[model samples]
Target: MKKRFVIWTAGIYILYVLVMGAYLFWWADFGVPEAYEGTGADPATFMTDRQLELSQDYSRYQSMLYFLGLPLEWIIYLGVLVFGVSRLFRDFGERVSRFTFINIPIYVLLLSTLTWVLTFPLDYARRTLSVNYGIGTQSFTGWMRDQLISFWIGTLIMAMLITVLYVLIRRFQKRWWLYAWMLMIPFMIFMMYIQPVVIDPLYNDFSRLSNPQLEEKILAMAEQADIPAERVYEVNMSEKTNAMNAYVNGIGSNLRIVLWDTTLNKLDESEVLFIMAHEIGHYVKNHLLWMLAGSIAVTFGGLYVGYRIFHVVINRWGNTWKVKGVTDVASLPALLLIFSLLSFIANPVELAVSRNAEKSADEYAIEMTQDREAAVGSFQQLTVTALSDVNPPALVKYLRYGHPTMMERITMLESYQQ
Candidate 1:
């Protein structure tokens, strides 16, 4: 059984390599259209020699850590099952409370804490690299505080999800996946509905956009776009990082436009308006609904596939792993491992869809604002401030980027003006 787990791990790596190679050597081979070729606003022109070098170095190092960390995480899940660590966790949880509901949270917290500890080195290394690059602003103590907050929040969510999942698994057996999927539809919507008002406030302070003039302009634009938003909100993010960002979040009444203070402070009025227009473009095009629909569809497929594979693996090795059945809290690692693999497989597809939606929004922003210069400047500023790779490797763009690359966006904007 342990040998089989090793083989499965090897197979996952092989799949990752094959997918990466295909993107690098084949799918990513296409060139920019000739119409966009003469854009004098090349990425090279946006940054000094030192800035360009720093950007490339940062990207390369970050990419390496990301790629390495993902597989290491999978292995941690595998290790728990193979080494009976998950069973020990389950036993400890049972000792803490006989009630399955109570025990589930205990087990989840234990697992979460273990993973958190094990993964801390990687997380800390990433943070250290960011700090060295002058991108991360949090103090070491503050960073750890955030990590603790994340752990508790994550544990609470995981516990609730696992408690419900096991209940459905026990009650519905083979059909548990369908029931879970059905329940998830509402839960996802509820999370989206509350995130802007509830979950987001935990991390940063949000208030109505301070610049009344800018807020009025944004609201007027939103009204023109038929957005329901009455006012724009700005979050205090400068204390956390220097990177600028803005987005539209939530659903229905909870739906609102949020700007990071970093964005408001760094960008000129025109660039900021263009950014807001791009966010408004998302609402105008109903991209959120579209994305939600896509997620529901992909999740349906993934959960169903994971359900099938979970049963097969459990049937073969349940006893060996000391996991009594799918209902066993000890079986959590198996479920997570299966889902993690599936999620990794689905990531590129998800990111590709997101890229297309973002491109559409970019076009809409340009159409709405009719200010190509502002759009171009915003993208350039974003790239510079974030130290983002303007033209990252094809594999990175395909697998990692959820939006069009900075270079791609600028080129399109420059071409649009022509």
Candidate 2:
């Protein structure tokens, strides 16, 4: 029976991979637009001639393909969930109730696939669009090198973390979810600190902010906000891409504001100051801490609900999904399937919390800058540079987007200006 179950599971997994791989390739080729043509006059006026062209090209390309690519990706994810759960229950018997050696690769593959899919659009923007627009300095080879490095690094870290969690779950199978989450808090802190300081630097250069005047202005803003001023630093992001971004990252020793080199080059001194102030707002408000808390709360809640549902479903049709041990390799698909379903149900709660935080940040940015026009212009520039959808579908945005739409941001700024 075990051998037969293994054969069926292998077949299903192979089919799932083939179908999803084909969909990905198809979306990349046909779903996206090849170029962008918009009303912004004289690329030289707004950005470098090469940068302007590249921006337009990416915008066009993305707009063309987004709708098609997004839906297909979601469908593929659902398919994986369905087949994975089915196989898990069939292969592992009662021993699956314990966390075991079975299905480790399956979980890893599911995680890797999800990560790759979610980040692919961003990666493409950074590599292909940013380069074509003249904002990215990295070659295709360089981008590929970065991707490979990130993949290995991510795999190693996640493997260690998952292994530890799996072991803990085996020991405390009855209350594993709660204990795992307790472990996650420290893990998250470690990730935030090391991710930027160590992992990110592997892909891009990190250095002290070079411009003293600009640095002072940012420090002054941080002081005005009553936050630590010494944590601001610059990273050589322009070495890879022209997309401008700033964020506050880490806890304690890891805490700092990282500014992309491209952001400094593109925005004037005041614009840079305003952007830094906005990021400082996140720190002042303790947005990161609250966000982490919210995520943990939701994850634990979901796991609790999932644990009850899994037992109930198995009681009725335990033989159908083939779930044996909670720790078994076969059981992974069942766990993932349940988790995805729970996440889908909890989507609105997650979106509302994220949207609220983003809106708060936007308000903070405007208040700090007191220059509505600069804020508005910055919003527009960000939309254009990032090739972001100005007006995405409401349902799609609700399901996927963490930030408010471009138009929503502009509208908010316009009201503030009035």
Candidate 3:
């Protein structure tokens, strides 16, 4: 059974690699455009010839990292499962549980902690690359401090989740996944509600926008969107990154529109307003609610798939894998591995939904502001300053990208009548 399963997975993996390689070769732009042909004369004016060259170089470098780091992370996870590292961790946790009242918490903590340690090197490497490219400026000590905070916070959350998951598994048995799916809706909302106030400030300092003129303009835009404007935030991301960004996050009273100082410093007034309007569009259109609903639906479907696969795989090789049952802590890595593959295959569907949401926000921003030039110019700036891949490979776009390509966004804005 084990041998057959291994052979089957290897065959699927080889086929996957071949298909992706062909897609990259044929669809990934072999050469990027040297100059812009967007709205106003000389979008190239925003970037010097030297800057343009550097942007392409940076884009290629980062793309290479994505190609390398992404597959390697999954490979490492699969390796851990194949080598019984999860069984070893489960044994350690069971030993620890002898001293504690609950085995699930101990097991979850150990599992999360071990996986985190294993993954940290790659995480650190990616951050190092960002810093080397002049994108990130956080000191190693600061970075470590943030990582520690995040590690603990994430571990606590997962512990709670795993405890509940186990409870569901034991009580509902066959219907556990459905119950977990139902629970996810409110759980996700609660997490989003707390994130702005609790999680975000652990890393970056957040303050009210200091520029009163700019703040007033943003407030006005929020008012237009009918979102609350009293508490806009500016994260001190300038200390950590050069990338410009803004987002509307949180639920209900906790909701906030946060701007990175990088955006303030880099973009002009019109461009900033357009960006803010886009974020406001998300809030005004109730995109968070819609996305949450979509996620709940996907969660139900995915959980069902996981439940089915978990039983099938375990029944075939449970003895070989040293896993007793679905509820056993030792089975987590297998379950996770199944979900990982499911997510990879489901990437295109998820990305399509996200890209559509982004497009809706883009259109909303344009309609509200009626500034085609500013809308197009804002994205053009992102392509230059942020090294956003303007024309990624079709395969990369499907598998990796969450938002529309910068060129697609710029072209969309330029072609818009209203």
Candidate 4:
């Protein structure tokens, strides 16, 4: 009986993947709407317009899937949960089925509501607490409005994606992960190229860098580093958030430097230069490509292990978080549970790699600029402006942080200076 049950489960899983893979491939190649091109405005204006278009497209696609997915998902989850439960407590099958079919929807709805409620306080803390600390500029009303907008927008989009994912998994079963990864590649590419162009501008206003001398200095630095200098662009970020930042993105003609207005306003020219130097270091080192390759490799490895363990657990106990195939609603909770646990275990390893990359960038900045004081000041200003915890616990740092803590960075800078 056990052997028969295992075979039945495996068969169902394989069929699920085959169906979902076909659907995902169709959707990836054809389902996406036309790309939006903004008017040839300044960099900031172009960015804002592009973001709005992407957000609208994303929202529309999401809404359609959200409403379509609910009932279908529930039915599959209930069917799988009942069948799996029956293997353990055969006599209690009827009772378990009755209880689960009724209780599962209620449980899920409550959980979703609770998550939204928890996010409210976290948002409040980010805004109100930052204001109290003199790091934020938005009024209470502005913050509240922003929070509400973000919440509703996030809820709608996530709800839709969850539905789509549930359906896909139900259709794909055990081999669903492979197809999902394949689908993710194009989605990730779209996000990388279009996201900064279309999505970011919705919340913030962008303007060109107004300082000629500073712009010239930045161009010089890029040229000195053997980075294409023409791609450098300044953005007015002060109209929305006060957080200071700089980043280097894209490659070849698409490559560009983005300096937020907050960084321009807060940091002196030298400090700004140092920050840009660090970002340029990332480009010079080809860190972005490395990160992407590393992430894909890790994900593939993790999924393989997870797939083996999932089948083993189900075989041993006849009760698994794994629901019917992939597209089923019940499968979502199981996948979420398993993925969350796996992600938690993998956090340290991921963070270690990220921290090393950051360290390398820091070293590169120092070497390129030969300006230790500028680096120290830039680090200090970043910590203060972002309101980052200066002394996070070691364990928390390992699990949660990508970059070394501010104190550690400053200490390193000091050591380099000596």
The top-ranked prediction according to lDDT is: 1
lDDT of 4 by residue, 316-406 (tens): 4333533333333444444444555677688789998888888888888888888887887787666555544444444446756788766
Candidate 2, residues 69-139: lDDT per residue as tens digits? 43334444444444464353334332343343334533564556565767677567645655555556787
TM-score of each: 0.92, 0.72, 0.89, 0.65
lDDT of 1 by residue, 129-190 (tens): 88888788878987887888888888999999999999999999899999999988998889
- Estimate the Cα RMSD of every predicted model relative to the unseen true structure: 3.4, 7.4, 3.4, 17.3
Best by TM-score: 1
- Candidate 4 local Cα displacement, residue 220, angstroms: 2.4
Better of 3 and 4 by TM-score: 3
Candidate 3 on 1-418: residue-level lDDT in tens?
A: 4466468667866776566555554445633365545333233556677766666566666655565555544655555566676678778777766532377777777777777887788788778878876778889998999899988998888778877887888788799999998899889888888999988998889999978898988998888778865867898888788889999998888889899999999999999999999999998888898988887788888999999998888787667767777777677777777888788778789899899889999999999899998887888787676755567766667767878877678777877997
Name the 10 consecutive residues with the lowest summed lDDT in model 1. Answer: 29-38
Q: For residue 188, what is the lDDT in candidate 1? A: 85
Question: Mind sharing the TM-score for model 2?
Answer: 0.72
lDDT against the true structure, per candidate, is 0.86, 0.64, 0.78, 0.59
Check candidate 3 and list the clashing pairs.
none
- How does residue 225 of candidate 3 score in lDDT? 75
Off-target runs (Cα >4 Å) in candidate 2 are 1-137, 311-323
Using TM-score as the measure, name the better of candidate 2 and candidate 3.
3
Query: Over all chains combined, what TM-score does candidate 1 have?
Result: 0.92
Clashes of 1: 0
